[model samples]
Target: MTPPLALDIDGTLTTPSGRIDPRVFELLPDWDAPVVFATGKAFPYPVALAHFLGRPEFVIAENGGVAYVDGETAVLGDPTAPRAVVEAFRERGGEVGWGDGDTVNRWRETEVALSLDADEALLREVAAAADGDVTVVDTGYAYHVKSPAASKGKALERVADALGIATEAFVAIGDSENDASTFAVAGESYAVANADATAREAADVVLDEAYMDGTETVLAALRERGE
Candidate 1:
């Protein structure tokens, strides 16, 4: 059987400037196997992408804080620790820098996503101080303050469980550190050419193409292998 696929958005499916690559509209909707969007982005982002692309809405969002599979929803992460961490950061004069509107985090449910420009050291210290349950992850695009328990690997496990699939049967593709956990759970994992050190190190294969081009390359390979 063709493997179920887990895909990361942002740096994986987007151009360097953060626009969705047009080819996704053509290929993803018709992919033979299941497609799961695994992203550190808020719940809506991946779900919305699946809607627009006409792919399966099976999604692992907020870095595993939330998931949607087979028309059911699961929320697994705690928002308290992340909120406390952010509050402490603000007290320490650290700014999240998404500006007043802060749409990036306004809708987030389980974690705090800060700009890459945020002070990592400060965020870590705050996370450690408030609750050891929360950990800090640098996704290359942003810093995530969340529970380690709520991660892509864990969410994938739940998805697999829900669908009677094996946790080790997925093929994952991504381009940053946020993808590392998913890589660990997958049967085969690919890091796009522009992947950060963590993702490249975790993946079984590092593709030559970058960004959406790399995603297309992997999809093409899957098609050929499926044939």
Candidate 2:
């Protein structure tokens, strides 16, 4: 069997607008291997996507703060990190806005999603205030304040162990800085054309196409290799 494929959701499988093109869904059925989703997204989003794919294999959420597999969910990091980071930010007079109403954000366990107006200084200040207790990761959509222990690479390792597969037997594809961990631990790492510079640098393969097209390209290559 071909090694599993671990994918990042936003900006990899979806458009910039965060919508999964129907064409991408059309390509899913052809890939005959475990498809694990590793994303900065919270809980239900990953679970829902797995259901849609008809592959409830494994999901790494909140950049690996949470993992779901085989009808079981596990929290891999300190769940209190988000609250501590938020409080520290507030104490420093930083005005933070939560993605409270958003369905996915509302379900987050180990991280808090906050939107900023490209205020890099404020982000740095918040990180400093945490004193290395937590980490602030920018997912392009929002800043995820989470524990330093959380990592997509670690989560992927857990999934690999659960599936009785070697850690180096998976193809990881992603498009952002948070995906750096996924790329680091993957046997083969791929980045779409639209991937951020950091992600592209970490990947072994950078596709010419973006979004769903890039994903399909990787899947096609995998199929060809297997044949």
Candidate 3:
């Protein structure tokens, strides 16, 4: 069986601005392996991306809370935390950012990007209210909180299981903190030079280029595997 190719969207398949090269899209469908878009973005984005690339077998969305397969959207994991959780956090002065809910984005979730002025006490309260199940990530700007079950790694595992591909026969490419866990199970993982330091540290190899030139980088790695 062809290996599963799990590609991250933000900084791996496209530029930081979220633009995909048509050339890459052209090459993707012909690839023998199954392709999955593992991303933190909403489900629609990856689904549209797959449509552009002409492949729709699988697409993991909203960090992994939702999975799209064969034109059907399945909630892989429970994204609904009790309303009390959010109310409790808010009561303690933690602000919440409401995201696209069953509309254009079709993602019913709330996000937390703590204000720079937020104190540790407030953050602690938010953490306590979440019961530690929220994803608290420091993106250098602020701490982000999302569903605990949503993650790129978990989504990759879902795709691997669906395709009947062994975890060892997977290639993962990404360039951000969200991509770290997924790389752990990847047979080959790559980080672009433009990637942040955290992403570089997690990847198996760091490329000296960008995703626009990713075809060459991936081809080189494949050749090395044959050697």
TM-score of each: 0.95, 0.92, 0.76
Question: Which regions of candidate 3 deviate over 4 angstroms?
Answer: 70-72, 82-106, 109-125, 138-144, 214-216, 219-227
Cα miss at 8, model 3 (Å)?
A: 0.4
Candidate 2 residue 95 C-alpha distance from true site, Å: 3.6
lDDT of 2: 0.82
Residue range 1-227, candidate 1, lDDT tens digits: 46789999888988989898888888888887788999999888988899988877899999999999999999999998788889989999998979889989988899999998888888788888865778888887789889877989889999988878887888999998889989999999999999999999999999999999998998887888888
Q: Rank candidates, TM-score, best first.
A: 1, 2, 3
Q: What is the lDDT of residue 134 in candidate 1?
A: 89
Best by TM-score: 1
lDDT of each: 0.89, 0.82, 0.66
Instruction: Go through the candidates in order and give the clash count of each.
Output: 0, 0, 0
The segments of candidate 2 whose C-alpha lies over 4 angstroms from its true place after superposition are 91-93, 98-104
What's the lDDT for residue 24 in model 1?
Answer: 87
Q: Per-residue lDDT tens digits of candidate 3, residues 36-135?
A: 8877666667888888778865887656666766556667545445234445667876654334342422344434344434554666565666666665
